[model samples]
Target: MMGTSGGSEEIIILSDDEDDKDTSCLIVEVEAVKKTVGVLPVSPQDEDLVVTFSRRPDVLPHARYDCPIHPFMPTDCERTAPMANNELICDQCFCYICDKLASLCGMWCCSGACHCNSHNKSDFWNDVRNTALLGELQRFNLTLSEVDHHLRNADTMLQSFRDELSALFSSIPLDQAMLPDYNINQQDLSSRYGPVLECVTLFLNKADKKNSRAAAIMHLGAAEEFMRHFQVLGFMGSSSAATTSETIIMLLHRVISSVQRRIVMGDITPLFMQKLQTFYQNRICFPADMRPLKNRFKCFIFGRNLSPVFCSLTIRPWQDVLLVSVLKGQNVSGFRKDKGKKDILFETISVVLLRTELLQLQSRYRELCRYLRVVLTDNTTLYQHLQDLIPFFKCKLGEFGSALESLFPPASPPASRFTPPIFLLYLRIFETATAPRLTVSQPEQLCFSGASWEPIKDAVPLKRSELVKFALKAQRCSLPVGSDPQCWASLLKVVCSPHGSPTALPVPSQQFLHESRDAVIDLLNQQGYNIQISRCFLKTYPDQALLLLVTGALGVRILQGSFSPALPVLHAYKDNLWAFQWLCEGMTSSEDRLKSFLKEITQESSNT
Candidate 1:
């Protein structure tokens, strides 16, 4: 109960006695119950008012709540119901208090001043509300921390490749002029050159005859494998360019020494052995070319110059010949200009001198046609003829004119790489006849869309090569996947850029930057990376833009809550992944620190 007048005043209550002398008025002096000193004098009425209604009708509104002129608790006087369980509460300020003290004091008065003018605590409402809000806050903070950490982690990952390439380039001294233009670390030298050289040494030593001879014989294959490996590692030059091999240099000398030693010993077979070794040397040394010389020494040990047995048009054992004898009597007349000069097409039998190996010939011929197709820009008819030429290379040049007319069909557009002829070739080369095509039941499944992943359902049966092609297509980048070109370009941009900053890429023209940036983004996105780029990305700095774009996109995606684990993508591009560390050398101190800082941020962010 609160009095209408302010300040510490006694309340006068009129008794309900029916005596003649008027009901004796009772004056009640409300004193502070607590004996604590220095208690400030407080007004009986509080400023803040809270009127609460009871669910039960038995509970009446206090009399102090009613007043004339200053009605409705003056719309400001503090008023509140007792606490739950019927605990005593201050009539002026709704603070909970002991029930026994409330009865003794005549009103539910708490220790706090009744007329205190201050704000009220509004935090607690319901247990459910409190729990829900707290939990949500915690979750939001955690997610933010996780996102921050992942973004940095992605930056570090991108920088790692850069670092690797840098380290590699640094290992070679400036004075080393004899080294290749693109020499990796000494380890690469050891990795590619070591095994072969070790084998060569064994071949040279007569005391180690068992190991040496075995290693020499196996050296050819090992050298080939390592050459391909180094090439994949971005160590080799172009396919057409010749690279000096340490193993080959040592092996040639070793062969010469062996020849000299055998000649001194008066060995009868020394000359023949020298010739055979020379042929093997030539085969290993030359790059693959559309020349019959490469295949001449393929089976040199079996005697390449045994005899020239001509079947029809002087087809020799030494010549790259594919003998075609049709059961039906028919003359081979439809001759390509290039084919006419290379082979003789006669009736009943056609002796085609294929300059390359069976598989190599097909590949070279197809590549030549493709190159010409792109160059001429009107080789649709020529391309169709080339498609038919695959079977023709295998000596099935039957009904050539009809086959060409049917395959070409006059004015039809040039067929895509997905044409039946190419697909059939891929099936023949890469897929086994006994193996079933991949389906939903297959072990490996490619992801095209992140939201809804389904097994690629093909109308025709799917070969492994087709699956590979589809996977590449799903990535949506013109850049070669899991290849050295991608790896080399990825690293080069960072290293070659100004002060090793991706954003500091040099642009030839300012106008091309925005267009190039979008293109770079699209390329990276196709490779399943989301990145951000400034409008300064230019076609001139594509390599730099690519590096920055991928790194930026990865960070953006990670921070924006669409992060997929990077390890899998890195693994898919393992060759490129391994190249990252060397690439990092081009980075500035800040960039290097940024990578380390990101690692620390993840930890600190999680703690927060």
Candidate 2:
């Protein structure tokens, strides 16, 4: 008996002398085969490669070495005995039974069986092939179904969002004028139409979670579709046009409210907020004409506390035009040609007021401070007036102290001084006792910055009878008794000779002479002046028709010697009628004092 020890196992071979010799030779051959097929020790760096199993081991089917099975097989073939280890296979061998590379087939060089040349009809090999093929088909089917399910879900969500959007649009009026009140309740809207907002939010959140480009594209498409629908409804018109659609405005309110809520709750990231802001600026608020209105709306929504940041994002610099117009109760048509923009302005103000009423005391204080800052920066003339007006709100001074400090901190640089029309308009709206004194030489710098010929351009031709009436009204109202009979006579001859009886005067000549006397009278009445004052200013300043039309007076003392005082006021205000009108409407001083002030300012400007 001979024994051999391999690791922990001991093999004992009992044989006759001749048999023992053959067994020893067989053991030597087995040891040589094991040495030839042994696996190399894996290095630490190659540990990952150890787990990488090849599923497609038959990828290279061509022979790697010369063999009898190939085209160069010799007629007389020498065949070597199969090895006793499954891992040992000739490079050129292939398993016919497994339909794979012989090197990858474990049974190809098995100790008791070699399947490299096994017949295709073998039952054992057929079962192995069939099991693998069935498993692959099953996996492919599951993968395809998963893709289909995801596609269907996406379609369903998109359709649901579309339907919800349609419902929300249907609830709001297309025209703002149709609404009973301009104010919209954000909470009420969220309660009633929250699903629409939630649906959009859900899509955005899912896209973010999945990091999916397709999902992101889908969200963008939906947003575009919503905007397209708005345009189709005439709510988002061209740059030169305007829309009063309550639907779009309310939609904006809801969207902004939702986004703000999400941001506050930590449901969205700053990156997402930035993207949304960009989308709003580029897509919703890009039009040059609509910029003023939309910026005002955004400014109101963000409130005064965030004004600094919001102001930077605004498409244009902030202006108080809308607020001034609204406070003055001026007709929307007087401010802008677009009716839609007018409605939006009113609506935005209405919403701001409504929200103010509902806010907590601190919030209201912040809002007050914001308004104070706006007045201080844009309409410095009204800042003190607002301080006076603040008392009427019944807010305690102590409560606003903190907010005021934050807005105008100690030793902070003073706000840039400006004299916007709002300054004068606010004074008029509040009916202040006197205009604020200006430290700057020309507080009305913006007023005289450019020339305007609108008075001449807008004049209408009038009949001879109308001219006679205008002349009579002017003579009765403004002419001093027995002072200028020759002046009246000359004016009448000049007025009557231009056009015969019942003849129409040329528009340009009549503009200089009359300039729509009736309309001027109406405008004067609108500005709280009586018919006598209107007719007197019109008749006395027939040569300064542009001045009369703009300032509602000759902008000078009536019956004052020399037109020098009037000349300065006219020169400073002729082109900027809008600002001049605001100043005139707001002034509580007598005509002479206003004229003196204009002369002083003009002198200061010249000296500077």
Clashes of each: 20, 0
Q: Any residue pairs clashing in model 2, and if so which?
A: none
lDDT of each: 0.32, 0.38
Give the per-residue lDDT digits (tens) of candidate 2, residues 60-116: 354322333343222111123242232334555556545467678776545444453
What candidate 1 gets wrong by more than 4 Å, as runs, is 1-354, 357-544, 549-608
TM agreement with the true structure for every prediction: 0.17, 0.21
- For 223-306, candidate 1 gives per-residue lDDT tens digits of 333333444434333321123343333344344334333322222133333433543444334333312433331211112232
The ten-residue window of minimal lDDT in model 1 covers 439-448
- Angstrom error of the Cα, residue 505, model 1: value is 7.1
Off by over 4 Å in 2: 1-159, 163-224, 233-244, 285-288, 298-608
